[model samples]
Target: MIINGVSVGPYQLGWRLQELEEKISISGFVEEELDKHYTITTNTLKFWVEKEQGEITQITVFGEYEGKFLGKIGVGNRLSDLNDLDIKWIKEDYVYKLPDYPGICFELEDIDDWDELLAPIEFISIYCS
Candidate 1:
């Protein structure tokens, strides 16, 4: 299913996962003293495509098992951090434009805890001509 122009499920563009336990640690919801859980995830991919009127498409993916913690999060977070390591400007044809390049964006569980550590994450939006 598609929600807010973002895709869902295995074929979607977004995901959240943790290979090891206690890595993407999440507290506050585990007051019940839960033990363990399983999670899988992917990064955010926002790119532009010819949608008849220059529409932007974004995709996100995430999944996890439930164990009664933090009210249940679809996917565990590695400290709720995101990264945009390698990025480059996207060209419509042969020219580059402002606001049309890849940018770093962070999706934090709590904006209050978001800091420089999350700088690696970002979002890329298309600039209007």
Candidate 2:
């Protein structure tokens, strides 16, 4: 999917972090840990980038913006909403996993005392490594 006009995924492996910052308007900072990480954020969306040896190792996204994740079906939506789009999802634990897109998932949030037949997305995650 596209984030700020830059395509991201396993294909984006090896892309430089500077390239993303220049291409996208999102704001973030690099953090030091076992591996270096850059976190980009909008009001509701967060993009995580991991680098090892100065090259991108993985990218992940999380948020609820415009009822989509990276412009694909995810977040800010109910589980039933995807039915209209004819997308397949698997519920495991509290996350809805998309089989069509590997390494992509949406976490569910409880809005009421009891779990509704339809659940709202709390966040979406796209893992690329």
Candidate 3:
């Protein structure tokens, strides 16, 4: 998977829900509609799409997703891994965002130890700002 500021793989922000359904079908994944969003799942990946006015506003990926964020970061990567990039992460609750990449956030594993550099990323989210 390829995740950027605006998209996760082929799932771009602002895409219609119908477009997602078609892509999901073509990818051979299963989609389940929750009260507020749709969950897409496969053997190795799980993600959710939240839509407003029929267009996707957010995409979150978690649970064994074996893809990199911007082809560099992903689950299992420690917070320290971003140090070389000189990113000043904006911390909010348990989520961290690169100052320059406002549309993407990484959720770390331990909420109680949010500042631990060794903390591995648990998931990633992309959204429209």
True-structure Cα RMSD, model 3: 3.0
Instruction: Tell me the TM-score of each prediction against the true structure.
Output: 0.21, 0.60, 0.77
Task: Output the number of the TM-score-best candidate.
Answer: 3
Question: Which stretches in model 2 have alpha-carbon errors above 4 Å?
Answer: 1-14, 25-36, 53-64, 67-74, 114-117
Rank by lDDT (best first): 3, 2, 1
Error of 1 at 6 (Å): 13
State each model's C-alpha RMSD to the native.
Answer: 16.1, 4.7, 3.0
lDDT tens readout by residue for model 2, 44-109 = 545556655454544444453444443555555776777777778898887777776566667777
Better by lDDT, candidate 3 or 2 = 3
Query: Tens digits of per-residue lDDT for model 1 on 22-106?
Result: 3323321111111242222223322232223323233332223222112222233222221222222233442222232232111
Which segments of model 3 are wrong by more than 4 Å? 1-3, 26-36, 41-52, 111-115
TM-score of 2: 0.60
Worst 10 residues of 3 by lDDT: 43-52
Candidate 2 clashing pairs? none
Q: Count clashing residue pairs per candidate.
A: 23, 0, 0
The candidate with the higher lDDT, 1 or 3, is 3
**Candidates sorted by TM-score, descending order?**
3, 2, 1
